[model samples]
Target: MIVGLTGGIGSGKTTVLNFFKAFQNISVYIADEEAKNLMNSSPLLKSQLINAFGKELFVDNTLQRAYLSNLVFKDPKKLQILNEIVHPQVAKHFSEFVALNAHKAYILYENAILFETQNNQFCDCILTVSAPLEDRISRIIHRDQTTRRAVLDRMQHQFPEEKKRLQSNYLIQNTSLPALKEEVYRIHNILTL
Candidate 1:
C-alpha cells in the first residue's frame, strides 16, 4: 500500500517521516527534495525557470533558491506557474520510485503539498501531521532562521489544519518525539493489518 504523508510547514512531518524510515520493508519518497534536485539538474526545468523568472534565478547552473522563494512568495500566480513546471516532473519521478518498490508491503510519498495538488487521491491512505499554529510558527522561526512574520506569511498559503485533518485517514500530533514515535508504530501496525 502507498501512503501519502503531508502537513503544513513546520508541522513536524519530517520527524515522523524519519520514524517511518526506521522500520523494515518501507520506502520513502520525499517530493520536495526530489523537486529541488530536478529543478537544479533537469535541462527542461532549468530553461523554463530561466524563461519564466530570469537568468539571475540561476547561479553556477543551480537554482538560486532564495531568489526563487522571494519571487513565488510575493506572487501567488508565479508560484502556481512554478508548480505547473515542477509538479509533473516530480510526479513522474514518484511513479518510477513506486514501481521500483512494487514488491514492498508499504511505501510513503511524503510531500508538503499533497492535499494542495490532490496527490492524496493516489494514496491508499493519507496521514496528516499537525501542531498548534503557535508551535509551528516557532519551529519554523528557529529552523529556518526567519522572522515570525515571514513564517506566518508562508503558513497562510497552506490549507488550514482543520481542513487537512478532515481529509486524512490518520492525524499525528507532534508535540513530543516519543509520543510521535509511538503513534507511528501504531499506524504501521494498523496499516500492516
Candidate 2:
C-alpha cells in the first residue's frame, strides 16, 4: 500500500512521518526533502530554476532558499510558478521511489501538496495532520523565524486545514505529542493489516 501523508504548513507532518518511519514494514519518502536534494544535484533542475527565477538565486552552486522563500512567499503567482517547476519533478522521483520499495508492505509518500498536485491519486489512502490555526501560525513563526504576517502569507498558499481534513481518508490531530504518536501507530497498524 502507498499512503500519502500531508498537512498544511506547520501541521507537524514531519513528526508524524517519523512515527510512520519506525514501522519495520514501512518505507518513507519525503518529497520536499528529495526536491531540495535534487535542486542542487540535478543540472536540469538547476538550469530550469535559474531560467525561471534568475542566475543569482543560486550562489556557489547552492540554491539560496531563504532568499527564494522571501521572494515567492510574498507573491502567490511566483510561488505557484516555483511549485509548477518542482512538483512534477518530485512526482516523477516519487514514482521511482515507490517502484523501488514495492516489495515493502507499505510505503509512505509524504508531501505537503498531495491533494493539490493530485499525488494522492497514487496512494491507496491519504492521511492529513491538522492543528488549530493559532497553533499552526505560532509554530511556523517559531520554526521559520519569520513574522506572523509572513507566516500567514505562506499559510494562505496552502489548502485550508478544514478542507484538507475533509478530503483526507484519515486525520491526525497533533495537539499532544503522545496522542500524535498513538494516532500514527494506530494508523500504521490499520494500513499494514
- Kindly list the per-residue Cα lDDT of model 2 for residues 1-193, writing each as its tens digit: 8888999989899899888877888799998899999898889899999998999889999999998898898887888888888888888888898889999998888989888777878888999999888988899889888898988887777877888888889999999999999999888888877
Give the C-alpha lDDT of model 1.
Answer: 0.92
lDDT of 1 at 37: 98
Q: Candidate 1 regions off by >4 Å?
A: none
lDDT of 1 by residue, 1-193 (tens): 8999999999999999999999888899999999999999999999999999999999999899989988998799999999999999999999999999998878989999898888988899999999988899889999989999989778877899999999999999998999999999999999988
Cα RMSD, model 2: 1.1
Give the lowest summed-lDDT range of ten residues in model 1: 149-158
Per-prediction RMSD in angstroms? 0.8, 1.1
Candidate 2 stretches greater than 4 Å from native: none
TM-score of each: 0.98, 0.96
Kindly report which residue pairs in candidate 2 clash with one another: none
